[model samples]
Target chain A: MWRDHLTEIIVFSALFLLVSAMGFVAARWRAPKDMAHLDEWGLGGRNFGGWITWFLVGGDLYTAYTFVAVPALMFGAGAAGFFAVPYTIVIYPMVFLVLCRLWSVSHRHGFVTPADFVRRRFDSPVLALLIAITGIVATMPYIALQLVGIEAVLKTMGVTGESALARHLPIIIAFAILAAYTYQSGLRAPALIAFVKDSLIYIVILVAVLYLPYKLGGWGSIFDAADAKFAASANPNDGVLLNANNQLQYVTLAFGSALALFLYPHSITGVLASRNRDVIKRNMSALPAYSLLLGLIALLGFMAIAAGVKPLPGAKEGSVDSNTVVPVLFDQQFPDWFAGVAYAAIGIGALVPAAIMSIAAANLFTRNIYKEYLKRDASPAQEANVSKITSLVVKVGAVACIVFLDPQFSIDLQLIGGVIILQTLPAVALGLYTRWFHRGALIAGWAAGMGLGMWMLYQIPNAATGRKHFGGSAFPLADFGFDTKKTIYVGIVAVLVNLAVAALVTLALRAGKVPDGVDGTEPDDYFVDESDPRVTPGPERDADSAREPVA
Target chain B: MTAPDPEAPEAPTAARSRAKDRSPWNWLLFIPIVVPLIPAFFNGDSPRLFGFPRFYWLQLAWILLGVTTTTVVYQMTKKKRGGGR
Candidate 1:
């Protein structure tokens, strides 16, 4: 099988290596005076312009996992899979309203992570620790899922081997290159490489949506094919159109996913790395263009069904991996060389986000965990060193997740990751707007929401892979004693429960006259822009100030 | 920690008033989020366009709606040049 696709293997290898080389050279793309500081290494100097931020954030959010999985969901589940389309569409307006404030306040305070903002806003190290740990935990499986994206493309190219080590060798090699360049150049590596990734993704998706549909008859026939496939399927919920039972799930899942998209540390990393508030605002308006792309991408799943593309067999007997649907479709339809380009698109797409996520998670650990607890007096250089090392370690752990655990387990964990990260909304997203929620209340809210989310996820079952628990994100309304069979997104329920707990606890604490933590930020801090007099200077300036004699 | 500037008291109030003036436009952001979630607006298969179902094409239209709405709000609320409040 591998021998049959020499043209593809060569093209994929050439492009993959080209991006990896670009990753190393990116260290000097916008070289800072001090390479050892967090701002320089972890954030690309916090000065990415509109174009870079647009591509970087788009590449970060629309991961290779999304490229593979969203369509795969459409291939398997039908209309429910289209939830991703609305999910991406709705996220921009929501973030446009909120994230500029975060960017402004973060610039004012020199905050590298959301936990940093939480730590100061609430003046509670414990709460910051919770946010930081949740971020790292939620991010790990997400990075692993990026690996799953690359692996799907590789598998479709017939790159598998007999031994376990052999099967994962290609992924390990690709990630090792990613980990190396990310270590050398930090956030700049992914920032630089995202250009290539997005170009490939746009070209491949546009081609597939246009050319494949034409070849497979037309859009009407594609929809008809999907409708017929779902109509003949055993499950009543599967179709091109929403059913009564699944409609609630579709809406709630889309909404929940939109809310959860930016809460992840990686999304925040991209947002904070921008040059200014206007950059964020412009990107917010412009970023939905990717949603248009994502909508087209999601339709590839239906196109696959229309083209009669069958999925490759899974590791287990009689099971098939639906994640391979898009890759397999590309393989069967496109010429060998173009198929390799699509494969490289997916492969490089994985690398860009994996690098950003590791950097984001590493920043969380170094700032909130390592500096706050382990070594309070660590300098900026030491902090950068820790983050650089932590990023490598995180990637190794993500690779281990793919190697040791079943890929299905990582997908399940990624679902739970959205829920877990949304638990931070009250503390991170809302706290940006108001500090009314008390510190203790926020922590309690997080715990309650996380606990309930896990419980709810455990109750839902996936009939496809025969998993009894932790199978999917759609929770049944009947489980809450409602008579209806309609299911809703678990994240939506968990977040509402989280908000209620936080609000009630806040009220209780206020009534008891419990002293809330000091608010370290002022209103003016949230409005500070680039080059503003009040904006915090970089660590180099702080160092210079410390070295100066007292007046 | 520095001594309070003479302009401090009026600065926040001016900013506050400006925010209040623009707050109505911010409400437009909710249009995109809310409109797409309403099943009745887009839950049907009739009214196909370009060989696509109404449910599918309308969702794509919502992306355009969101982009346009956000762009309008962004333009309306954009801060003026020369650092004016």
Candidate 2:
């Protein structure tokens, strides 16, 4: 069976090689005159226009995980998985208002990381450090999820499992190549590679959505098959449609996920790299084109059912490996050559965002951690070098996440990361519009949110594996007695705690006559455009001129 | 370095920029927000569109709706007049 896939492997490798070459050559695609500067390397010179920004942000946001996991969830659990479609839909409007303001302020101040904006906004390095740490921590599991996506594809391709180490060898090699180009090229590598990733994904999804249903008789038969299988399952909540019990989970999950998606440093990396607010706005609306694609991609779960595709032999008897359903489905339904294209799409889909994610996390470390703490006098060149090296370290941590942890846990940890990152919303997202919350209050809010979020996540356990913890996002709303079956998203619960703490603490701090921290931003900073004269960086206005160079 | 205090006097141009920032077109941003929230109003499976469940098809339609509304808002608000910065 494995040997028969030789043609698929060759096509997959050929496309993989093509993208890897593109990743390396991207270093010179938009050659910066002074490539040594941190902004130039860390952010693709922070000047991408609407078209490039669309692809970059699309590729960054709709990751390989979307390709592999969302449908997998639909295949395994039914209606709950479709939450991703609504989440992606609402995300643009959610971010459109907030992110443009962020871009304006960050650009005006020459801030590279969101933590940089927080530090300047609240005048608290400790708060900034917490935000920075949260970003780095949240990003690790996310990058791990991407690796899980690639590993699933590789496993489906029959290239894994010679030995324990041999199983991960392909993943390590793929990411190592990712790390090298990202180290050499920084944000530019992913920006250039995004073009290819998005194109291949569009082609594969467009073809699959059109071709799959016809092969399976039509949408009617596909839903009928899905409904029959789900109805026979033990879980009463499982079905082809949402039930009273899961409907609230769907709404809260979609809303919470929408709120949390752009808070990640990688999403911000994509947003801040755009040339102007207009680019950001234009891309936000247009990028829903991917959501349409995602909706179709998710239906592959139903297609898998209609095709009678089952989990591979290695999966535990009588249970499904949800992650493998889509890959196995494609393998069963498509000819070897097109299946190769589909597999390559998922594989390369992982690389683009992983590269961008590492760069974003590295920027958080260098700008907020290394520069702010260890060496305030670091030069631009030094900063760039530190970020490049940190990108590599970040990738190593991601590889560690997938290598050492159970793949299921890595998936759950992603939700936990969202819970952690949403804690920053009070300080980072709100601070863009108001600084009324005292810095002390914001810190307390973050602590409350992070603490409560982790506790809830720890309590949820997997029924299938009998695992005691890190099972999933749906936590029982114990406070609402007799409704234990009704669960809310962990992120929504945590952010509520964050907001309550912030509000109470802010009022108390105000009553006590506590002095607020210095606000470093001006009102005008939130509305500046590229053509604005104040942002044009004259000799006297050079944003980086004040920092003293350190050896 | 910290800017002085929020209590410090703002320039007239800055105040004017703040006022202008509240464009009527900014109100259009709520469309994306409202469209997604519509699912909660009619969350059921009975009204299946072409065999796709209502809960499913409604959300998918909103995806395109979100894109269209955002595009209109973006076009209207893309050009900025004189502002404080």
Candidate 3:
């Protein structure tokens, strides 16, 4: 099998090794004087200019999983899958309005994680602990899903074997390299590598969208083929157009996902690493260009259908993994060498977000869990050391998730991941804007939201996979005694329940004269720019102080 | 730097108030979020563009609209600097 695809394998390995070398070299890209602080290691010294910020955040948001899964979703479910386009479209405006506040306040207060901000804002370590744990839990499965993206490409490249060890060995080797560089270089590794990842993705996708249509009839025939296939299908939800049953799910899923996008610790890690508010503002407007690319990417699903691309067989007999559709599509149509580049685009694409996500989760652990609770007085060097180690542990756990559990299970958990992170919205996103909720009330609201979200998810059934429950994110309204077959997104429903509980609890607490947690942040803190004198100094000054001889 | 005293009287009131004032331009952010979500507007298959259905083409168009709205808002609301970087 390997001998058959020697050309593709050689090209893929060459590009992969090139990026790994760059990952190690990235540690000295900006060459900070000291590398033993959380700011230096975890956030690229927190001074990335506009272009780096653009690529970093863009690469962070549009992961390899998105490259594979969005097209796969488009292939399987037709119009319902197109929700990702609107989801990306709606996120930039929300980010523009909301996240700059988070960036400014986090910089002003030296808050490393959203939980760090929550800890200071609500003045409650317990609440901060909840936020931190939620972020880390929601993130692990997401990192595992990135592995699924690479696995799809590998399977397409014929790197499979009968033994389990043979199947997972390549992934292990790739992630070990990723873990080493991320541990050494931290956020800088992914920041520097994203340029290469995005460039390859653009070239491959632009070429595919332009060339594939011309090869397989045209866009009109592609749409016609997709339409005819779905029209003959039994599922009411499958079509080139949205139907009455799934329309509500489409809108809510789009909006709910947009709300949840930046709430993820990785997204915030990308945002807070920017040099200033203007870097964020400029990137917000510019980043929507990726949405255009994403829209084109999603259309690859229809292209796959037009090209008659069939997914490779799965590990189980009589089962096929739809995730392999795009990879197989490229392998079948493109020549041997260009197909190799497309595969490398996907394989390398996985590395950038995986590095950033592990770093983000590690930052949450170090700041909120290890430092806040484990040792209150841990020095900066110690905190950075703990973070570097914790990032390695997170990657190992992500690998374990892929090895022990079925890949389908991780995808389901990622759906729940979005829902779980959205529960933090009231605490983190809204907290950036207001201080109305009591700390205890926010905790109660979190419990209510999370409990309801999980229970709703448990009630969902995936008919295609033949799973009874915990199968998907679309919860049927009929469960609530409604007569219709319409389903709403589980995250939207749970978040609403969460907000109502929070509002009522806040009112009762206020009427009872319960004292609120002291807000550690000032109003002006949210508007501080890079040139502002009140902004916290970067790591260089701290490194200078540490290098001084003891008095 | 030491942590600020939580009870200290608020300084930078001008900057605070300026940040608080809701610019009308900021309201443009809602257009992208709200417009694409209304199902009745872009749900049909009529008026296809470039061999694409109305639903397909319109969603892509909404992306362009979102980019434009964000760019306009960013330009309008950005604080004018006295000295360029």
Sorted on DockQ, best first, the list reads 1, 3, 2
Docking class of predicted structure 3:
acceptable
Worst 10 residues of 3 chain B by lDDT: B1-10
Question: How would you encode candidate 3's per-residue C-alpha lDDT over A124-206 as one tens digit per residue?
Answer: 88899999999999999999999999999999999987788889999999999999999999999999999999999999999
TM-score, structure 1 vs. true: 0.96
Residue A4 of model 1, lDDT score: 88
- lDDT by residue (tens digit), candidate 2, A132-250: 99999899889999988887777788887756688899899999999999998889999999888899999998889789888889777888899999999998777887776777778
For model 1, fnat equals 0.66
lDDT of 1: 0.90
Tens-place lDDT digits, model 2, residues B19-85? 5456788787787776676556446766778777676778888887788888887776545443234
The lDDT per prediction is: 0.90, 0.84, 0.89
Rank by lDDT (best first):
1, 3, 2
Q: If you assessed candidate 1 against the hidden native complex, which CAPRI class would it receive? A: medium
Q: After superposition, how far is residue A97 of candidate 2 from its true place, in Å?
A: 1.5
For each model, chain A TM-score?
0.98, 0.96, 0.98
Collision pairs in model 3? none
User: Poorest 10 consecutive residues of model 2 chain A by lDDT?
Assistant: A542-551
lDDT of 1 by residue, A1-551 (tens): 89888888999999999999999999999898889999989999999999999999999999999989999989988888888888988898888868988988888778899999999899899999999999999999999999999999889888999999999999999999999999999999999999999999999988988899889999999999999999899988888888899889999999999999899999999999999888998998899888889889999999999989999998888989888999999989999999999999999999999999999999999999999999987888999999999999999999999999998889888999999999999999999999999999998999999999999999998887788999898898999999999999999999999999999999999999999968887776676677565565576456433432211
Highest lDDT model number:
1
lDDT of 3 by residue, B1-85 (tens): 1245334443443254345435888888999989989889888888878898888899989988988998888777764332122
